[model samples]
Target: MSELSRWEDLFREGNLKELSLGAMKVTREHFGNSVFLRGLLEYSNYCSCNCFYCGIRRDNGRVERYRLDDDMIYAAVDSGFIRGLRTFVLQGGEDPEFGTDRMCRVVREIKRRTGDAAAVTLSCGILSRESYAALKDAGADRYLLRFETADTELHSYLRDGVSLERRLKALEDLRSLGFQTGSGFMVGLPGEDDELILRNIRLARKLELDMIGIGPFIPHPATPLRDAPQVPLEKTLLATALLRLFCPRAHIPATTAAGSLEPDGREKMLSCGANVLMPNISPVEVKPHYLLYPGKICLDEDGLHCIGCLGGRVAAVGRKLSFDRADGLICKRRDRVEAGT
Candidate 1:
């Protein structure tokens, strides 16, 4: 169990209670009681690529696509500020209509308005170095583009035109620009094996990234892999804990998809190794509109309405949810200050 040569060793070789306890202890040692809040705003749902696992694919007829304009994007940021959102995650499909210029303007405007009140993290799909530089110059503090997988062939089959090489290049580009880069995977992906999962973890650690966004594989009804099996909730929990043990300092999230699979999923993930939680701040009416996968958690409420519920929900797990380090990326060790006493 201690060796961790295989991922299953995290579960098969020992009792889950102790594993959970170990994860919590590490979580405390690294993050203490603080949890970061990242205001997630899906600005657009118009995707160029037809991923088999997403509902926003260009080929999905049932999905009603929409793109929020600059004003609407600004309004979403303002809304998060009112509700105590200190970090803003501007995520959306790789819609060309927004363009690089438009995207930069939106980012710069947000940074101008928010000042140091929050950090702007970009999850807009892949792009050229020029585009990345432009966004970085516009003052994006972090970037999150889930690698999805380290296997090139499997990733290509799922997402058209998104090569594993390009994904890594993007991560590299972000790092070169001095931005905190985050990459992730979808556990239980079709045709994925244990080796790939282990490799993905190894790659994330090797990349020396600032954040990791591992989540379960949830299928979309309109996508090609509609009938695909969803990732097991327990497996997701184990991954979270394993991530803690592997990279104790990395920013890890108990993904919402995990919570969607089960009531205690987020709590279990936090107890295992998760240090961050991204509550949906998108509008309630449009929540179902930005469907990346089926049965997505936190879809019923907007950012304003969900804070109270999420605060209570985190309390159930014997944790606290706040805007401080809710995204779990930025580093500020508190132990040093207390040691001075």
Candidate 2:
């Protein structure tokens, strides 16, 4: 059988151990035993869109919304920098207050504060091509916008009125603008199956993504899918392994949703193929309010505590936290350009 068929069979049969081991080998071969760190700053809980599965959707009146201004955002970056973090993912809902110019300034300020030694990653949802180009010009290095699922119907159903085609176009725009673009999907999303998961992996390879975030489906009490069941921990890990095998050079994170499902979820993912961990750097007071899903981990800890604890967990699995702001092979190309190669 071909490699794809082999992976499909393994996924269909629930052979997680074998799949994970194969994935680990693939990861080590491409990235060695070093895991990159991206300090996640959920700078805002306010969003314009009302996605059905999210906790902080615009319609969720129960959410205590908050948005950190430039000063607060810079302070968070300062804290992460002091904790040996060289990368920051400034993620938030699509808050209208963060206009293109304001967002550009945020990226420029972060780059300036770190003396241009940091990789500023943005997960602030979709934007126009002009906005994307503006941010890139302001020193943004990477952009993560998960397509959620490859299936169009499910994508529309989960994202309310948003179309999958639009999301894909945004991703392409990011790639064209010279950003290290990343995308991913949720495993075990309602109405999704094993074949769909395989398709998601294939889509990642087709897109030539620099990173893929494979997170589990965790239901939130405030959302429409509140009654939905959580995706099995094993299935999520299996999807992670599959992604690693398919996109060997892509950076996959042991997402926080995995850790919320089980104590050792992140550790297990690190062993499987995940080479990235995003410790929360948003202020401790706002962490609880930034909940995208219930029972999210590390909401109580600051950047210092989260990094310290994560360091021990990463070391426990025979890997070390990387200070490098690497976006798979994109970093290599940037280095080459700088060196006039």
Candidate 3:
């Protein structure tokens, strides 16, 4: 019943790749050769809070702020749908333009336009429980809220006084509302140790999360941690594999941050244990400005290009892109619900 002993053994004794192979097998068992694609639409970059590690934080005067109107957002989703995408992840900074009513309208419109064929995911920052419920009523199927780190002090330091309790409460609220809730952590963060990373994995399992997104800590030149060390690729891969080993059915992404860190990072992630790919379908002109960290890949490409490129990458790793809208963690949970166990 010791948490560390359970999760830590997978990392020791030069067994990183071995653990990855086991995780990959588990991933295949649950997901087959299908990798789900979520079209990423970064509709706005004007954030209200200034997280120390983010490039688009409010205090960073260099960021070019922009918010796409309803027409432009619909246009982007329309383009992605034509290219075989069935899920749209509406991500953005905490822009006030996307209030509860406006966001619900967007979600309702996307569902209406796609005949409910497209799954809408909201990744806008923390909102009230009422707002979360309203979005769900408007047909949003998934929600992503990264916990960032498991350590409370580290979370406070990184987010500039924000409490981890509030974040966890928001996650709980989302799950209570039947969202396929996702929470993530960063490997090699400024104050993180192996123990902290293992706790993060434990936390994900404890939450019964539907999905988890693990990526390396990449520093942004414009942020407070500009001089912090970049997370080693080996460490990040180890963390991804470990998450898969523990949470066998969670939807894990080969994050664009990883790919930007190493050219073949995404492919390696697929082999390691990842089962999701979020291609940037955001407005191309605004894509370059939505920099969470430096050196983000595929900013130069459009939605169609990302679809074709990621499709090729998925195939290269001997897996195929999944066209199913409900192919992620939510479907896996249905069995548990039906059995009432």
Candidate 4:
């Protein structure tokens, strides 16, 4: 049988034990027992695009949108930094109010405050090449712009006519600008199949991404895909293991979406191959409003509390929670460039 057919059979039969073990072995070879932790700050819910599966899409009337000022953003970073988080992910929707200049200021100030102690990662969605270069110049070390899917038709449909080509272009821009680029896809989207999943994996490899985050698709009640069929979490876990085997050095996170699916879902992914965890450090009041899908965990918990919980989770699975900046291969390459090596 062909390699694709073999994987298809494994996925079809729901036999992931051997696959997961192999993935775990590869992860151990590369990352050892250290799982990097990134503090996720969802500072805004305002977005420009109206994606069908997103909870904070511009057309969604029910989400209470709010953007954090510099003071609030700084405070969140300070809190996480105190708790020993060296990597802070400033994530939000593509709000125009937080334009290039404002974002540059934010990145610069954060770097100033943290000195060389922290690395900042941005995930605010697609932007112009100039904007990306400006952010990189301002001290942003990593960028996550998930392409969502490899199938052009489903990608455009889910994103309301935004072509896969456009998304891929944005990723290329980030990479060319020397950002530690990260991208991912949801495991079970409407119209997604084994072929599409395989293609998604191939695309990640083709991009040579520094990070790969895969999560299961969960329906948001307020979005167009509210009534979409529920995808099994096992499929997502299988994909996670496969991603690990395929891209052993890429940083893969045990996404919150997995935890939302089951109480122990994130932990399960860790066993499979994931070596990173991003605990929500956004303010408690605004956490509920930043929901990309329903049943998101940790909306009520404070940053320190979430970190404490994740520490236990990591320990339970025999992995250490690393406080290092955990710069991936791409980020290291950027460092070498800046150092004139």
Among these predictions, the greatest TM-score belongs to: 2
Question: Model 2, 275: alpha-carbon shift in Å?
Answer: 0.4
Regions more than 4 Å wrong, model 1: 1-8, 11-15, 325-341
Off by over 4 Å in 4: 1-9, 330-341
TM-score (C-alpha, index-matched) for candidate 2? 0.96
> Which of the two, 1 or 2, has more TM-score?
2
Measured over all alpha carbons after superposition, the RMSD of each candidate to the real structure, in angstroms, is 3.8, 2.0, 1.9, 2.1
Instruction: Locate the minimum summed-lDDT window of 10 residues in model 2.
Output: 327-336
| Model 3 segments more than 4 A misplaced | 1-7, 330-341
- Which lDDT tens digits does candidate 2 get at residues 1-341? 99878987998898988888899999889889999999999988999999999999999999998989899999989988977889899999999999899999999999999999999999989999999999999999999999989998889999997999999999999987888988998887878888898888889889988888988889989999999877788888888888888888889999999999999999988988999999888889999998888999887777668777888999999999888887658546655787899
Query: How well does candidate 4 score on lDDT at residue 175?
Result: 87
User: Candidate 1 vs candidate 4: which has greater TM-score?
Assistant: 4
Error of 2 at 291 (Å): 1.0
Scanning candidate 1 in windows of ten residues, the lowest lDDT window is 327-336
lDDT of 4 by residue, 27-122 (tens): 999889999989998889999999999999999999898998889999999988988899999998999999999999999998988985899999
List, residue by residue over 1-341, the lDDT tens digit for candidate 1: 34555444655454566667777787788788656667789888998888878889989989888877788888888988877788888899989997889989998999888875688899987888889899888888789988888888988778876688888888888777767778888888888766677777777777876789988888887888888887677766766776676777888877888887887787778777787778777767778899888887767777678778777867877788767734333323322343673
**Clash-forming residue pairs, model 3:** none
Query: Who is ahead in TM-score, 1 or 3?
Result: 3
State the lDDT of candidate 3 residue by residue for 197-258, as single tens digits.
88998899888888899898899999999999987788888888888888888889989888
Q: Which portions of model 2 show Cα errors greater than 4 Å?
A: 330-341
